[model samples]
Target: MQFSADTMFPGDLFEAATRFAADTLAAGDRANAWQQAVAMGWPALLVDEARGGAGGTLADLGAVIEGCARHPVGLPLVRRCAQAPALLMAAGSAGADDTLRALCAGQVDLDVVDAPALTVTALADGGVRLDGVLEGVDAALPFTHVLVSAGALLLLVPQDALPAPTARFVGIDGAQIADRVLSGLLLPASAVLQRGEAASSAAAIAQDLAIFATTLDMAATLGATIEQCIAYLSTRVQFGVALATFQVLRHKVVEMYVDYESASVLLARLVADTVVTGRLAARDVALCKLYLNELARRGAEASIQLHGGMGLTAELPAGRLARRLLCAGFAQGDRLTQLARLATEPTAARL
Candidate 1:
């Protein structure tokens, strides 16, 4: 039942993604990075094939993520971007088709309602009222539209229709997090994406996909960080030939490698299971998220600590990995939130 990475990424997708990541990752320029990703057609990774996208699977996206791990863009790009298009494809409506085209063309970005600062209210005449302040929006790209969830119902609201952003929070890597108060902004009936049962169902599907994609991306990023750490430890000299010669540092590297492999195996199995079932294995996703978060933190901290005084320096890749790992926790749900969900799942199912 064990699945290898080759079983998931079957073509040049891996090579293309790796080359793209290598060229653009950690460039410290969002505009340049986004343009490169668009050129590679990565933003449309999961859009339906008929929609002018590459029409690839989650595994393809996983390969791109793995390749980009040495230098990551953002979780939302894989999570929300991929998830939104999938939902639009599912809607199979005229509006969805238009949005799908825009998304695949890399003309707009999508937002997830993770922080819940905005409130959606049903208005008479079939319109909806959105109020309250939305905070912690991971808006790295200049978005043309946003997907907002109201009462678990997915609603597509044009960015122009929403209130202007009044404040912003910037990440250590220069990513922008927008905060805005939507004061009684009214969306027409046409903005209704999924309502009633269909609305919640689409939300669940998108959320599940986001969780699964984020887990694989985390594994890839951490795995690359571990490799870099091992190389540094094996070459840097101490009182002896190299730091790798030390049994303690060697043990640390081995443990971190094993952890990375374990996470990778778990992710592969989940991918296989999803492909086979045509549905998300929620219990497993929760476990993978919880398990990988701890691994990412430990691996990053260890990489930095093992690198000695130069570890935390900006020039060192270890510091960058550590910083990224620390920053990405809140993107989906944080580790604590994921852990609580995992605690309720059957122990046997997580395997």
Candidate 2:
């Protein structure tokens, strides 16, 4: 069945989020963003109502994401509202209740493990040892706990158990990122959040949810960028006429808008499928990511090329928007990695 975005997500939530993000999306004001998110009850959108949350649906979450896309904030809203909640629900661990409450209250922030760099060793006494470096992690927020998956086991490691991050700096997208160095960090049996098949399943689903949220956010931001470009072109005069009057420039802006529209349709379908099936198809999610990456690159170039020198400066919103579009690919796996994954999929899935 075809999905209509208007029918799926609530209008009021999107409007409210748009209003909130407009005033608070500026960089270096993470505390204000967090406070506003809490006030809006965004962090609890996915947690069950009984668990002191809003008991909202995925569509509700999408509404807020769409609104925030007007100006993307650097908060961990995707992880907090989508990934962690999915992980906790899939694990069915009562012990996660306090963590959920803390998250709802904005008392703690959580980050996902990068998975590849870390080495995990299981102890006979039900403990685990971790040793390795997590490179270029966006743990700049006061992340109090980390969600980690070691093979078929999932563990929640407290921030105190690991050393402080190094080489910290604000990224182009205004995220405070650093490299986390882990040396023989050990956690007791109680740290295990899930094990066996449950852990593996939980980790996969959580990541899928996160990808869904992220793709929607990126697409919305691209749409906003397209709007900004149109506004600038219509007003900026050149060669005795507006830039929008130039056929070449008008065509480029149209192309960007078309790409943004395509992404919006794909996101709508993905959201509909998830709400109905309660799961995301990995292949579809990867396809969305790859498509958005390509779209972002194209949009970024067209935006910068059209804006000329102004696009190169940080003082303008066009430049900042383009930077974010380009950076989205690097946040998870780059285009090359995603291409390889698709290349390795089964023949039927590929078809």
Please tell me which predicted candidate would have the highest TM-score against the true structure: 2
For model 1, the superposed segments whose C-alpha errors exceed 4 Å read 1-11, 26-28, 73-76, 90-94, 115-117, 172-174, 343-351
TM-score of 2: 0.89
Per residue, candidate 1 scores C-alpha lDDT tens digits across 1-351 of: 111222234358777766666666545566677666766677787776788778777777777777666565553565545667667766656766777787778776666554344577899978788888767655666566677766655678777876767888877644577877888888888888667766666665667677777777778777777767877876788896888788998788778888888888878776776666666666777777788788888887888779987877767766777777766555567888887777775544311
Q: What is the C-alpha lDDT of each candidate?
A: 0.70, 0.75
Q: How many collisions per candidate?
A: 0, 0
Against the true structure, whose lDDT is highest? Answer: 2
TM-score to native of every candidate shown: 0.87, 0.89
